[model samples]
Structures are given as structure tokens and as C-alpha cells.
Target: MRSFLLLSGLFCSLLSFAQTDTLPVFPETPPLLEDVLQDAEEEVDFDFDTYYEPLEALREHPLDLNRADREQLQEIRLLNDLQIEAFLEYRATAGPLLALYELQVIPGFDLPTIRRLLPYVSLRSSLDDFHVPLPRMLSAGKNELYLRWSRTLESSRGFLLAGDTSVSGRFLGDPNKWYTRFKHSYENRLSYGFTAEKDAGEEFFRGSNPQGFDFYSAHLFARNLSRTVKAVALGDFTASFGQGLILYSGFGYGKSAATMEVKRSGRVLRPFTSVNEASFYRGAAATLAFGPLEATVLGSYRRRDGNVVVSTDTTETQDLPAITLSSILNSGLHRTPAEIADEGAFHQLTFGGCLRYSSDRFAFGLNGVLDRLDQPISRTPQPYNRFYFNGNQLWNGSLDYTYRLKNLLFFGETAVDPNGRLATLNGLLAGLDRKVDVSLLQRWYSHEFQSLNGFPFAETNGVNNEAGVYLGAEIRPASRWRLNAYYDLYRHPWLRFRTDAPSRGRDWLVRLTYYQKRKLEVYLQVRRESKEQNATDYFGPLDRLVAHQTLQARL
Candidate 1:
């Protein structure tokens, strides 16, 4: 166990520079993204797809700092809400920034923050004419294509099996996974890309999916036109707004070394090309801006694979057939006949829209979404399942806002389901001084609160049957030394998959890092978490419930 934790920490630390080669001028990805994804992968597992479309897009199309608003500034990830507010205020009163180095004078920006942000941001005059001619946009665009394949040496059972056509037989293809992408862009104003991937256990050219790959995605996005259209997407894309209580299609960092990583930031419409097979819009989405106000509308039709059972016993009594599902099976693996049988068994339609208004220090947004399924959903019999969405059609609408006061930035969202069950998430991000920063998030999702596609910042996976509080801080006492820590206390009001009764849990992480120069860094991290789960019978005299404890340190 000691060696396992030590090796786990080293493995993650070594992956820090992995994304540098993905683009022409890709700098070593800031460690903030690497650590955030590592924790998110451990939390949600398969949902943490290593999609680089957005980051690559940003690097190729750097944000012009002088013209960027609160939303555009937030996309930098290195800028917290407090820093964003300060940046806009500085530009408003002092006029356009004379140089990029002016960031050193910003209230909340530290040296490390400035270094991390320099790659994706630029300082340009407001009248620099950021627009591109349509002919040059199409004729002078840059294009890149990438193909990658990977496999494991020690394989799972699906890789080696006796030759048989039975349902229990091995996977149709080898254990190797395949990925390929093609992208075209012109200074971030115009972009079109195609991405495709096959999971490890899925077939290559046989069985249910005869195509070369199990998944394929294509998108074309153009932004910043004359004055009417802010953006447009012909195909697949993702959207995130406010603090992500209503719609956060893009993945944001959770708990990480950067204490203020709590804020979620991305354009309203972004190209989506992750390995996660669900939760993305497939048809069309667009954003239109008119001065201080902006509007967005989107609609999608996609097929998802899940096991579904129609109950005949209740069919005669109701107009719709009762459906039950064990899980959504997000692994994207189709090895055996049982797995293949679940492919595209359920069809769905998702449509939503958002209206946003932005001022110098305040922003307000309204978002609404509707999800319809060909088959109704019924979860396994559990206390937590009582409030889960049941009907084939579901809808959620929310109002989200952000307001700034001095060094503190306050943000929150209030959402409701079709029946009025409510979910609320509120947070505060403040820069105590030049050397310290802190963040607080409190979430309350009613027992019956649900949104089929709503993903918020919380301890649980989604906004349903869970409530929690999170607090985090980052301290820099010197130019080269920094400390980060956070504590999360949460409770599941109803039973979950592994636990038989309601439970409470807590998690905490602390990390220290030192840098001699921008080129050299050394870091140490310690983490501990406690949660309740079903216990084994090995420990005599104990109840069926056990508190799972984990402690790890990396130096």
C-alpha cells in the first residue's frame, strides 16, 4: 500500500508536460490543468476525456486582453473571478493596456499566475481591427491532422478467449485503442475539425459497429463577425455558463493546487471532441451578441447505448411502458454480446438556450434545457432513486449571476425542474491580499431535484440528492514558495450504490511547491479522504457499513 501511493503520485507528476506537442506552439500545459484532470478522473473516472480541441483552439487564437470582457477573460483559467473583475476595471478606468507586462500590477495576479497566463493572452489596442476578411479566413487557414494508437501489455479477459460465437465470447477486436483528429483554423476566428476514437474493447470492423471506429465527431465554428453573430457551429459543440449550475458542457477543474480554480470559464459555444460518448449536443448551436446582451440557441439529436427493460406488468395500467436501467454504462466498451446488445438502444433529443447580459462588474444569464427519451427511465430500488427523474421527457431552467465587490466575487445559480423541485449552488471567491486567496462553495440539491444533463460544481456526480460545502486556499509567502489546501464536507441524504444508508464524508488535500526559476519546480502533496461504503465480513463484530479511509503523500 505504501509503494502504491508513492508510485501513484509520481505517475501523475510525470504526466505534467504531456500536452506540449499537440499544437504548433503548445507550451508545457500548466500543472493546474494536469492536477485538476487527475483528480476529476479519479472522481468521475471515464468522464474525464483528454480532449484538447478547446485548449489548442485558445493557443492558436489567443485572447486580445484589451478587448476581452469578463466571459472572455475567464476562459484563460489562470484568471480567477476576482482577477477578472480587476482586469476589466483597470482597462475601463485606465484605458487599453499599454503592454502585457501590466498584468504584474493587477491586484490578485501573482508572478506564477502571470507566467501561466502569458501563453494564451495578448495585449492589443481596442482599434487594432480584430476582424478578418472572409477570403483570407478561408484561403490562408492552417490545417493539422493527428493519428494515435495505444494498447496494454497485460490484457483483460476480453483480449484472449476461446473461439466461440456465444454471447460470453471475447471482444471482436484486439485490445488496442485508436484515435485520430483533423483540424482547420484561422486565428481562432474560423475552425472546423473531425475527431474519431475507438475504445479498447470495442471492435474495429465487425459486429454491431462495422465502422472503423465506434465514435466520430465533426464541428465547424466561426466567431467574431461584423456585429451580429458572435459564433456559429454546424455540428458537435459544448457550452458552459455562470458557475455551471445550469449548463456546463465543458469540463472545469474541480479541487486542485490552484485554490481559485473553482470558477468555470469557456465560450458559450465550443467544439467538442472528447471520448465521453454522451452529454454533448450533436445537431446545431449558435451565439448572437448585441452590445451588452447576448443570446444563444441550440438543439441536438443523438443516440446513446444503455440497457433498458420494459415492464409489462405496469404497461396495462399506464399509457407509457415502465422502464428500468441499472446504469448508463459510460465505459464505451463493447466486448461481449451483452455489451453489444446495449448499443444505441435508446434515442434522445436535447435542446436548450441561454440569454446573457454583461456589465463592467456584473453579469446575469438565463438558461433552459429540455431532454426527451424514446424510453422512460426507472432506477434500481434504493432510497436515492426515489427522486430520480422517471418520465421520458424532462426539463430544467436556471438563473445564474456573478457580482463583484472589492476583492470578493460572488456567484450563484438557482435551478428548477418541471415540477418545481429546486437546486441551488452558491460560491464566493476572494483575494485576501497579494499573497493569499480563498474560495467557498455551498450546494443544496433537493432530494427530488434533477437535471438529466445539468452538471454543477459539487461533491456528488450531478445535482441530485446531495448537499455539500467546499473551502480551499492558496498561500504564497515568498516568490518561490507556495502552499495550497482545501476541505470538503458532504452528505448523501439517501442511500447510494455501495452504501445501504445515508452517509457523510469529508476530503482534504494539501500541497507545497517551490520554484527556483520558471523552468524548474519541485512539489509535494498529501491527501486524505473518508467516505462510507459497504463493508466486507472479514472484520468481525462490525456493522455492514464501513468508512473507507485513504491517505497518501508525495515528496
Candidate 2:
């Protein structure tokens, strides 16, 4: 990881010193982004591009604070609802902002928050939403192209025998990994881009991949094109509705050191520009606004890679055997013959819509989504997998609400599967003082509930068979010092993989940070987690669950 960071730093230095004036100069990567990447280093399928591309786009076309609406502000993801409400109220009473430093007067917008927003916002008011000519919108946009490649310097055994077809476990292609991206953006209104990638050991421009790259994604997104149409997306995209129970794709926020920023907030529709192959829809989606009410509808059809199981009957006379999917794979890798065999094993069709009404003090949303597959999915049955969804079709509907009363903001979502099982999440954010803010969240998801694309804040990877309460607080004790902490207590009501019975857990985290004027910054974080898992030393046929604890601290 250190070497990788050094290489990235060197590359950025070269770009920064280049003679080309057209190249955009990006600000330093935010600490929040670095923390997210470091936390997920253990995840084999994690892609850094999924999170970096949006910030890059924001730098290229910074948001106009005077003209950006509530939805656009929320997409920034740096401000909480309380802060947003405060900013909007301030703007309503004070007129358009004359200077960026005026944010210091807002109740919840502290110096730290203002500093974070400096890179992504501008005080100048841009063009009106209406009467924008198409030719100018296209010709005035910024165009960018990026190409990157990486390969291991050491000679591994597999790469040494690259062309040995008779040898087992030999690499089918070279060790080079390649990536390319091209984008055009017209300020904050329009964006279009395409991303292509080829993983190491994957054939390029030959054999399995004659198309040059293993994966390709492209999208065209426009915002505020008309009074009725707030946003529209064509090609690849992602959708997120209230609390992410019905539909959520792309990057997500979860439990982290930034305790107060836990809520899921973003635009209802966003263009897909990441290299992640399976997490986005590949069709079209649109959002329409009328007064205070808004409507969003989307439809998508795409191929999915899955582990296919063929019928074992030998007496069948047919040339091809009946096949069923055992599981879906999201690694987006096709380096080996076995991995290649699972490519595009099935096709999926998805359609969904959301209806929302928003005002100064209240908001409500109704979301519905349905997914259908060309082939049936039947996982190998196990005690832990009994409640998993299996079939050709699945549907879910949810209702989410948010209300603001003075200094407190309340939000929650309730969803139901076709079987009538329920999943719910609710939370509250309160500003007790100018320098103190706190948050509370609770969730209950039945074991029978299932979601394919939903990503929520929880201890477990999936949002089922769990109930928990989380309490978080942030405080500025002094001029340059801040304190953050959170505690979560959760329980799984049903059997999980490797566990024979119900289990419970608790997590605690505390972080202290100090920031000095433009010269020095430091932070210390300590975290402890205790959970139940099967005992490793048990000699009995059926292992017993035992408590396990782990502690970590970093500075």
C-alpha cells in the first residue's frame, strides 16, 4: 500500500507540472476519501474508481451554490440534512450569498465543514435553467481523456508460462492491467463519459476479448433541461431513493470514523462513470419535477455473471442441459477458464419508479422495484440460506419520510417484500448547541426480507435478520480540537453461516482530531468489536458458538 501511494503521488506530481494549460488541476484528495479506501482494502472486489470519479467530476465542474437546489446540494455528500436546511434558510433570508465566508453565520456550518466545501463550490451564480442553447452547451463543455496501466515487476510462475496451453494453472494473457476514460461536462448541467478496463491475465483484443477491453460502460446525463424534467440519464446509470431500501447502487456510506455523517443522501439519478461492471443499470432513467412533487422512473436490462449448475442426468438426449444459477458473482474478473465460463450466464430485467414530495419542513417518498431473471436461481440449500430469495422474479415496495422541526431532523424508511415481511430504518439528528451535534439510528429487518441492490448502514453485509441501534456524537471542545464517537449494539435473530444459533454483537469507536492553521493536523482513533462465532476448538460434531473480541487503534 505504501508503494502504491508513492507511485500515485509521483504520477500526480508529473501531471501537476505538465506544460499543458488545458489540463485541470485537482485539489488534494480529501481525508474522508482516503479513510474509505483504507477501510475497504481487504475487500477483493473493491474498485477505487467508483468513489474517485465523482469527486473528479465535481472538481472539473464545481457546483454553483447560489443556483444549486436541495437535490444538487445533497449530491455533494459532505453536508448533513441539518446543515443543508440551515444553508437554505440562510439563503432565503439573506438573498444570494455574496461571499463564501458568510457560511460561518449558519448554525451547523462550522469552519471545518466550510473548508471541506471550498473545493467543490463557487459563489458565482451561473446561467438560468431555461433558455440554454444546445450548441453552446456542447461547445463550451470541458473534454478530458485519461489512460493508465499497471503491472507487477516480479516474474511470477504463471506469467512465465504465458503461452503454455498444455500446462495447468498458466496465465492466459499478460500481466498488464489497463484502464481508459473519456468525459465531457458542461458546468453542472450536462455530462457524458465512457470507461473501459482490462484486468490482469485477461485476454485483450484476442481470444476471449476481441473487443480490446473486458468491460465497457458509457452514459449521458443531463440536469435541469426543462421545468418538468429535473434529470435524465441514458445508457449506464445508478439510482438511489430514500434510505436505500428499494434501490441503491454505486458508492454508499456506512459506519466510519466520521460519526455524524451516517445518513444516505444523494441525487435520485446519477450517471455511471466507474469501472465497476455489475453494480449499475444499463438502460435509461429519468426524473420529473412539478412544483414540490417529483417522479422518477427507470428500466434496465443487462447480462450478469453467475455460477451455473447443469443437470446431472446422463440419459437426456438434448444437446444442451438445463442450467440454473447457484449464485451471482460481482468480482468482474475473467482471468481463468472457470471464471470465463460464468460470464453472462443469465440476463436480468429491472423496472422501478419513485414518487416524492418535498417542502421546506417535510418530505415523503414512495418507491417500488421489480426484478426478473431469464433463468431461475436455486442456491445449494443450507440452514443459513433457508430464507434467501430463489426464483425468477422478486419485487419490493417502500415508504420513506423526513420531517424537520426547529433544530431536529427525523428520517426513516419502511419496506415490504412480496411475502409481506418488513424491513425498517429510522434515525434522528439533533443540534443541541452551536458546536455540538448528535445522531441516533435504529433498524429492524426480518430474516425473510431480501434485497438484491439495497445497501444500508448495518453491521452485516446484507440487510436482513438484524436489529440494531446506533448512537453517534460530534463535539468541538476547543478552538482546534474535536471529538467523535459512536456505539452500536446489534443482534442477528436467525442462524448465519458458521453459526448454529442466534448471535449478538457490540461495536464502539472513539476518535479525537486536532487541526492547526494550514500547517499541521493529527487524529487518533480506537475501535473495539465483540461478536459471536463458531468455536474453533470444539471437538463435538456440532460446534458451539462463542464470543470473540477484537481491538484496533491508529494514529
Candidate 3:
């Protein structure tokens, strides 16, 4: 009996090893005999109902139509690539879809496909409300069309005319200035639109010079990919390079110096003549990102021709190229507030530069600029002198620090320009003509900031010695409000011409703002300045006050 039992055990062991190697392995031991038998029975009971249950659940909980992409839409098994493309193109041209039957109009979409997709599409306005529903008047695939028209009326005081007329005029505001725009988008990814404006005002008048349609901007663009890359073009657009040292092009509208005047004894006294010039720069810019590194490059050319002085034509043409590179770290030697408490810190270091070459067919100059920003210090400096001197003769550097104190943000920067002497030399050179000798007319022509002739009445060259510290804070008391305050202490040793006098000055600015939904914002600011003068033979005080209010709205 014992021999027979041993032989039987050996046979069973061989059978178990064979089963383990040949079949899928579960745990160390197989399920109980009863459970295994029951599982087998369940597999035999499988039918179409079991498969359709999950499919029905997924269809009832389909993805949001507003944000769904082609892949997600295809997962429903009712749409294909061609159908998706047609739908996207149609929606882009027609606007938001309002009915799912509209999909039948798209190529490749048929009755069977629409019936299969009916349970998974919705026409709700809110993305969160998107859910399976029966067909209704408003369906997900039907496009909606909307049209809008607007007009603006603005009056200007103290407006300056480009002719021989004096700096005084009050004319009727532009009455027929109208704006029209058309936009159509589907799934928020595919979109296209066009906008145009027309104005009938005195400026557009021919013989009598009535402002009518002085300027207009029109553009048409479509977004190919919304998440990663986007493309845009404008007939007349504006952009800046680096810090505006190399390139800055756009339409600028502000108080023109010629139009701005001071009221003395009820008489308007103009400080400086003003010129209004408007033009457009056509260009392209893009940003690329890979892991912790990012790069941005842009290039553009602009042509501006307008009135500078009465009767004298001024035109300038310029080309600019700019690039920037940055590296980010999440831990180790460089750390930021985001990584400080989690055994590491996130930091970023960036280096960027731009160059601009300007020419007017007769004169040309090349301007180059460089900037560097490392952890704890973000430096930004423009090499204006390099462009004027035609070499790398000027350098500016800065060190900045940012520290997070619980819920507070504290930051400061210390900047220095070692090549200030070169700037001073340039100012002196500008005061002299090509003959290298100072001209009497040039003396008076030199402004207060650029004069270096060592005028006996004032120390005109002293502004070259400039060094200062800026300390400010951003305080948030409410979710929609903020306060900013800053103090500046600047010392100019060159401003001190006589002994036993203070040469330092102090200035401060405080601003308060209220923001709501990033759409509406208002701010109030105040500034005060005090300085002593020894070169001008005047020492006590000079102060100025300015205040203004502005408003903006977008739909």
C-alpha cells in the first residue's frame, strides 16, 4: 500500500508542473475547485449583452463635445478621420454646431453613423452639462450663425493738425466709424474669423481735410493646433524685442508733445512740438520648449513714414531679430519656492539677446543687446551705447533676489552700468557738429538730460552719475484687490559741484488696483520727488504732480 501511494503522489506532482507551465499562472495555488468550476461556467455564459452593457455606459457618459478631439470622438466607434475633418472644417466656417443631424451634411457621414452617434452627442451650452440625450432643436453638430456691428464716437481736445494751422481745434467726432467682425469655432480647437473697420471723419477729408477713415486694421487667421502650436497673422501689428533696445514697432496713441500744452494765465503754452506717426510691422515669432529648456525666436521688419516737423518728411525702415534660451532645474544647487520644502527647489536661468539693423537708404546702424537671469538674480540691461559707438563698448548688469516669506513675496534688484562714461562721451559728441567743435545752436538744442557742456548756470553733465535702489511690495488683502508701494533712493556724485551740500535725492510711488475676472481693472497712483541742485546755483526744491483715469472693456 505505501509503494502504491508514493507512485501516485509523484504522478500528481508531474501533472501540476505541466499545468503551471502550460496555462496562465495565478497565485501559488489555484482557486478552490468549486470557484474554478464556477468561473468556467461564467465564461461559457458570456453573450452580447455583457459586452453591450459597458459600451452603453461609455456612450451615455461620452466625452465633452466642446473639448473633445478627433481621437476621443473616434473612440465612440461612430466617426472616422474623414468625418472628423469634415466636421471640423464645416464647424470652423459655419460656427458652433447646434444639431447632430448636421453631421450628415459632412462628407463620409451617413444615416447609420448619425444614428449610432446620436446617444453620445449633446447640444448644451455649458461643457459640464454635455451628456447623452435625444435629438432636439439644438443639436451638437448643427452650426449657429451670429452677426454683430458696432460704432465708436470720440472727441479730441487740443488736437494738432499736420498743416500750417495753429495748435487749436475742435471738430465734430467721427460719426460713421463702424466695426464688424465675424467668428466661427467648433470644439474650441478649430476656428477662423475676419474683422474690419471703417471711419468717416475729418482726417479722411480730401480737399477740406475732413477726418474720415484715417486708418484701419483687418486680419484673418485660423488655429490649426490649439494646445501645442498656434499660428496668427495681422495686416498691421506690433511687437517688441528683448527690452525694446533693438526693436519696437506698433501703433502708438498718446498725448503728442505738440498737442500737449500748459495753461498759464489762461493761455495755452506748448512745451515741445509733437508728431503723430502710425504704421505697421509685419513679422513672425515662435516659442519652443523641450524638457527643462525653452527657446524663443522672432524676426520682423517695419516701415514708418509720417510727419515729424511741418513740411519735412521722415521715414524709417528697420529689421530686427531676437532669441532667448532658458534652463530650468527642480532640485540641487538651484532651487525656487516651488521646490523648497519638498527636498528640492525649482529654479530657472535664462540668457537672451537681440539685434536690430536700421536703415533709411542713406544711414544705417546695428544695435545689439544681451541679458542674463539666474536664480536669486534676474538681470536685464540694454546696450544702447554699443549701437551708437558701433562696437561692444558698453555693458550693464544686475543682480536680483526673490524670497518667499510664508504668504508674502519679497524681491529686489541691484543694477549697474560700468560703461556710463561712454554714454556721457556720446552725449558730448552729439553736442558738437561733424567738425568736432561745439556749435552755439547745438548748445540750446541740447535737452536738459543730454547736455554735457558744463553750463555755468547748472551742472548739465551730472545726470551721467546715476545709481539707485528700488524696493517695492505687492500686498493682496482680497482676492480681487492689490496694493503696490515702492521707494527709490538715488545718489549722483556728479550732480555735486559745490562742497557742503547734499547730492542725494529720494522718490516714492504708491499704486492701488482692483481687478475682477481679469476683464475689469482700475488703478490709482501717486508719486513725489525731491532733489537739490548746486550746478544751477539753485538748491531748494522742484516738484510736479500728474493724475489721470482710464477705462477699458472687452466682450
TM-scores, each model vs. reference = 0.88, 0.92, 0.31
For every model shown, the clashing-pair count is 0, 0, 23
Encode model 3's per-residue lDDT on 1-555: one tens digit a residue.
111111111101112211221211121111112222332312421112212322333443444455555435643434433345456556766877767667766644544345556666765555332232323211231122222223333332422232324423423233333333333223322223333333323333443223433333333222223223333333323333321222233211111110100000100000000111122233444333243222334333332221111223334642332212112221121011122222211112112222222121111122222322212211123231211211212333322222322222222222234443222111010111111111010011111122111111111222234444434444445556655454545555432333223255665555566766526656665656555544443345632222222222211
C-alpha RMSD for every candidate:
5.6, 3.4, 31.7
Minimal lDDT window, size 10, model 3: 260-269
lDDT over C-alpha atoms for residue 176 of model 1: 71
lDDT of 2 by residue, 196-220 (tens): 9898888999988998999999999
- Candidate 2, superposed: residue stretches over 4 Å from native: 2-21, 41-62, 154-170, 314-320
Between candidates 2 and 3, the TM-score winner: 2
The C-alpha local distance difference test score for the whole of candidate 3 amounts to 0.30
Higher-lDDT candidate of 2 and 3? 2
